[model samples]
Target: MRIAVPLPGTMWAFDVISIIQIFDDDSVMYGSSDRPVIDFIANASSKALDHGMSIATTALRDYHEKPDLIIIPGFANPHEIATDRRTRDAKARLFTADPADALAIRDWLVASHREGVEIAAMCTGMFALAWTGLLDGVECTTHLPFLDDLAAQFPKALVQKDRLLTHNAKQRIWTSAGGSICLDLCIALLAEHAGQSLATAEANMLMMHYPRSVATRRSDGAPSVLPRPSRQSDEIIALTRRVREHLSYDWTLTTLAQTSHSSTRSFQRRFSEVMGVPPSTWLLTERLNAAKELLELTDLPMQQIALRTGLRNADSLRKHFSAAFGVSPSRYRQDFLRTELRPTENV
Candidate 1:
């Protein structure tokens, strides 16, 4: 399948490459060694940036071969530019007024959809796609910080507040949240086009645990673990301890209630009363917290950690991680490791 990626000044580079790599893998089920081909083209009007940075053109005109997918990567903000006023102003003009890039992308997206092509956006690229009006009435997600802005700007679109990826089958438009979640979306796409095994292999090659579905929520407003009054509350704590001890076990409300010597209704009530959330919600959070600790201190593969933490599988763990931290397991580990190794500033 051919995928077209339009480049705008300040587009985040990693977002573009993550999508490209999945389709480029020749060993995958969807890929063919003989005819495995994926194409990327930068659709920008001028190849030269006024700031002295040069961008190459894969195609001079926007109309080339129709791509099966078109992508727009997130852009750098105005505040991030350190160049002179002229360069900054030029960038602003290019982005706001130069409809060449946007129009070309819009035409390709509309045409591709008419011919059964898929259009996707990563991070803030959702803004550009939303501008095309194709995402109207479609469910989509963008970077969390921009959720409010995207909703307000495009009231016609259904903006999902807490999702790693959201899609509207009607529009065939897919959007993903933040940077690392872009990789998750690509893996999911690979799974759909190829098969579960190929997706798992691709994830293993990248050292990424397969990502979870985007519907998971990080918070259920649970209470802290400190002591609370009452005999029932203490029993709830004991049940929590048992849950933690056997995280790999399939825990059900009846199982927990039986272990705690309480009815399901009583267990649910007391657990929620003491923890400020349902028992199941508390258990999931505990598992996720334990997984985070293991990720921080140990170099265990995500699948092992998931098994140890009682998550259903690696994909489920990634879903929780993405929802809780907005990053994949590997990226979170690297980031934590970097912070841990950083030299301490003298206080």
Candidate 2:
């Protein structure tokens, strides 16, 4: 595969260089001759980019016929970086990028996309992609801060805030929540070209887990408390999946124990040994975690949340939620939760 990166005048330097390095380093780790070739292209060679630097690029001479994939890199946020006026001398041009440059990039991207070049965009780089009208009716994501803007700017495009990456093979477009997560997009592209094992090995070499496979509407991606086993106990794993799938089930200690093929007393003892907490404690924690997730990701009424979490009612959930989080559900959602388009008011 030949991937072309269009270095527009407003493109972020880090987004360009880091994505290049990720592919290069992982290709080395992949240790294969059939690796994808990445090309850095420019609208014109030896031009200054708006993010305080200049670059020279040439590989894709004619946008309509050259590359298999095209990457649009995110640039510095003109509004945010301009706050410290005295120190941001190099990036001042970002505040007033030429209208012609913007329109030219959009037109070229639209043409290239029409010619069957798969496109990947990072963060605000999506604006150029969206401007071509190709993102209409397509699901996409960008930086969390730009989620609202992307939605507002392109009303026909679906904006997903919680998702780290989105790919629509039909449109040949891929968008990602930007920043370092751009590398996650790189790894995913690597996995697509190579295989999951190469992706897994590349991720392990980077000392990071593969970001996500199928994304849920979640913002809670905290690190695992337990070290991941290379091979998990199938019984425990399947049991855990079942419990989560039906968290509202009225689970008695005896019923859960029987699922593990042990007496209640023996199960409790082994469960405590394995999880470092009593089984009862684990149940409560899981229920509360479910409740908290509902609070963050949805505006579901309190009684509905309680039912899904197995707390059975608003009264039961409030009692446990207050003790564990030290705040009301409304307040927690207000403080931490951001919806795909807007934050929820008290529900």
Candidate 3:
């Protein structure tokens, strides 16, 4: 079965292209696996759109021939933007606005649905799908921050926010959560056609781990590791959870041992044996992870990041961040922003 992805105006270049690359770059999949090819189509500026992006594709001679699946990639919907009243207001409007691009897309998608195509929308793209009126009287979801907006705008639709992915079997439509869930959506899609084996292999290749399905509550509040042998170490798990909750607090070995209700020697041995790392090393790694996430996901200053991750100061943030990522925090943020899909006022 074939798939189609429409490149509408204001589309996040990264969101659209990541899905494209997943299917188009079969070389990344297993050597013997069968993968379906996806078509990318757009109406205007065949060569260009938001973020100065373009793709090469052959114009389909027919619109009546709907592909088996239509994957609507997400658009960038940043929580913050430059601090100008007009720009901020415009950015706000464009995020939820039903622009001409979305209206046109709605019309086309409604028709494709009649042809029995399974439709999937990622992140804010769900807003466009909702505009089609097809989501009315159906259970759906979108980015966590915009769940209220989606519900208010489409009162007829049952918008459930807790889910990372929502699939209406009757409608054959799938909606995935925002940001990184695109990877989750892609992995699930590939698993649908290819087998779990191929999807797992692709996840490993991409440095991502696939969930059981879109419906499963992911145990991904933190980075994951091999499963513990039994639930007896629930106390240690509880202690670790507390550490994440209070990452910035000054934590010492004595305090950690007391928290775990064990002697310093016993606590260090148990933590190392059960969690695969000593408490000190694990704490350092967690701090480094927190700093890295802040750098990649936010525009927060180094001092703020240091304070948040318990690094204590900007210098420490730089020293540890650079050691872990091989780049300073500013350089790392610049490299991330270059590829990140910041929603466009026009898109």
Candidate 4:
């Protein structure tokens, strides 16, 4: 059977690939293995992990054939987690590397799933799969630290917050929680094709338990390793979430501080601590991001797009978009349109 793995934001992606490779060889599985064929895919530009490693990846759009299974690995967002452990916005962070790139990957995943490919996500990679709408009304789980955020962001998903691993048998989707438990997910997937005995033996040889053990949850339902954020930090996170959801609102530092129930000074200090950006700067960045998505996905006029993103006018949108992307809005949209019309056309 053929398997596809998308090169994700985390170095754990490599770990997942390594496990698959170990089971892929003839010596290991011999007569019992499915003899899996693996492919590493990414968007046009290869993704660089936060840990300073990069891999050569086949562009998913250029890969014509669908594999029997697709595995999405956890995304690395250590900085965000470190700042506010309890409020790690999984969906927002999914767009951190590049919104267009993330959307392309999500679109490909949606199309591939519709074609009958079994999809699995390791740890917080469930955020990527959730963005594809495959997890709606289906049982799923992610890294414990991200459980609350994942549920808040994707409410339709039946998120088993305490489950180390869970599967939707009908849809052929699987999810495993954080840490080395992702290794267990790979073995579980193997059992679907290979016999249980072979899978059990492989787990034994690897010194991992065959079946998932009950994951202990704290009384407060928080990940023990990630201490809850301070009340001030939670307030700031809530304010930021509101800002993201309502980009069309006219937001100012004073108004933002009011929303979070803090003074201007305290609000600025805490917001910077949690988000690593001053309120105004973060607002501009988010507004421009909304504008970028609008440019790519809609046929609205520049003025309308600017208004929708709270940029006031086309000229303002052009200035900020050109400054940020090194191209005017129209040019960027033109390039996107051409790419859409000729998907296989290489840049």
TM-score of each: 0.56, 0.56, 0.55, 0.55
- List ranges where model 3 is wrong by over 4 Å: 30-33, 45-50, 57-64, 77-104, 218-347
Worst 10 residues of 3 by lDDT: 80-89
lDDT of 2 by residue, 1-347 (tens): 56778765556777877666666675465545435566666556554555578777662345444566788888666244323233223332332355455456566778888988889888777765776788999999887777877787678999887777888867888888777768778776665444344555566677553244223233432222543553323455566668867999987789889888989988776554444445566677668767766775678999999999899899999898877545677776665433223432221
Please list the C-alpha lDDT of all candidates, in the order they appear: 0.65, 0.66, 0.67, 0.69
Candidate 3 lDDT tens digits, 165-195 = 7777668888887767777787777655443
lDDT-superior candidate, 1 or 2: 2
The candidates, ranked best first by TM-score, are 2, 1, 3, 4
Which is the leading candidate under TM-score?
2
Which pairs clash (backbone N, Cα, C closer than 3 Å) in model 1? none
Report the Cα lDDT for candidate 2.
Answer: 0.66
lDDT of 1 by residue, 288-311 (tens): 767876786689999999999888
Give the C-alpha lDDT of model 3: 0.67
Higher-ranked by TM-score: 1 or 4: 1
Most accurate candidate by lDDT: 4
How displaced is residue 214 in candidate 1, in Å?
3.1
Indicate the residue-level lDDT of 47 in model 2.
48
What are the RMSDs of all candidates, in order?
Answer: 13.9, 15.7, 18.1, 20.8
lDDT of 2 at 9: 52
How many angstroms is residue 19 displaced in model 2 relative to the true structure, after the best TM-score fit?
1.5
